[model samples]
Target: MTKAPHRRGADRTEAIMRTTLELGQEIGYARLSMEGVAARAGAGKQTIYRRWSSKGALLLDSLLSLHEPALDYPDTGDVVADLRTQIHAAVDLLAGPPFGPLFTALIGEAQYDPRVAAALNERLIAPQAAKTVERLQAARDRGQLSEAFDLDLAMAILSGPLYFQLLITQEPLTHAYVDRVLDALFTGLGPISRAAGR
Candidate 1:
């Protein structure tokens, strides 16, 4: 007879995820291990390994849980305002404690580990990019953007500077910086037709 899958309570799962994020922030993704997570979470090693195949998987789950709530696309009819809100939310999530350092570590580790790269891309990057694309598409449909606007390129342009400031320049991602980025992008992308006279 086949054995039934083991199910853990939500409390236990939250404990594990909380522990993983804490350790990830403190020690970083490269130094994080399932053993350490299990120990810190007050669970057995097999308990963690049984639930997650690797450290990357565990960390990915924790990261997603922490930041998923803020990943929604805002549809307030003003493309510039929506983009600003989205970008600001992203900066808040990725520039604050626990998530920020954990994200930085995962991104750094992903440079050398394909598994981490894939997980981060799939769980975090791709979804947020898709949301941005959707928002841009909506703007295009509403005649706020040029018909020939490239969504992929738009998303890259919108997000690239934030990541650059976050990871490369190590500069503060302030509100003024967000507004400047939006201003520059909107200037090149053309005026917001729908939001005129406001």
Candidate 2:
């Protein structure tokens, strides 16, 4: 049976996104082009252009699509542990092959391209930050975090160092590093009694 035109269009869009990420990983984002993606995806330039106006928009969607399925903010009763797990998972995702290099490229490109920056902020950064904020707010409501705890600062404290390691220092994002950072931040946020195991 022939697929409907809209269904076929959806399939083509998926193929384009998938091919874009694969090419981004192989050639690096600095060299990736919509023409290349269209060729690799088995779609015409017009098809890709119809869906995405620029490589930045297409690449942003590709990155978001790649990470969204695996991204989750855990709430395992222990806020500290949950945050650690989330951070560790994120580090693993961003430090591993394909995604690691791709994300690094995206960050670098974002520094110079306003379109990429805006797309990244809207599609990736804002959403993840909101999730972190939501988790911290939940912890506060449960008395795990003090009312005075600044959720925004907490989110930055959680993510900023990891990004620094990923982009600037190029240090290993280890479990120990995540734990140490979390411990230091939690120390200033107030102590939590684990007697009830929450």
lDDT measured at residue 39 in model 2 versus the true structure, 0 to 100: 88
TM-score of candidate 1 relative to the true fold: 0.82
**Clashing pairs in model 1, backbone N/Cα/C closer than 3 A:** none
Please, what is the whole-model Cα lDDT of each candidate in the order they appear?
Answer: 0.81, 0.83
- Model 2 RMSD in angstroms: 4.0
Cα lDDT tens digits for candidate 2, 32-129: 99999988888899988988878877887887875573667888888898888887877777777658777777777788888889888887788889
lDDT of 1 by residue, 11-67 (tens): 788899999988877887778999999888899999888877778778878878755
Residue 42 shift from truth in candidate 2, angstroms: 2.8
Give all TM-scores, in the order shown.
Answer: 0.82, 0.86
The positional error of residue 111 in candidate 2, measured at the CA in angstroms, is 1.9
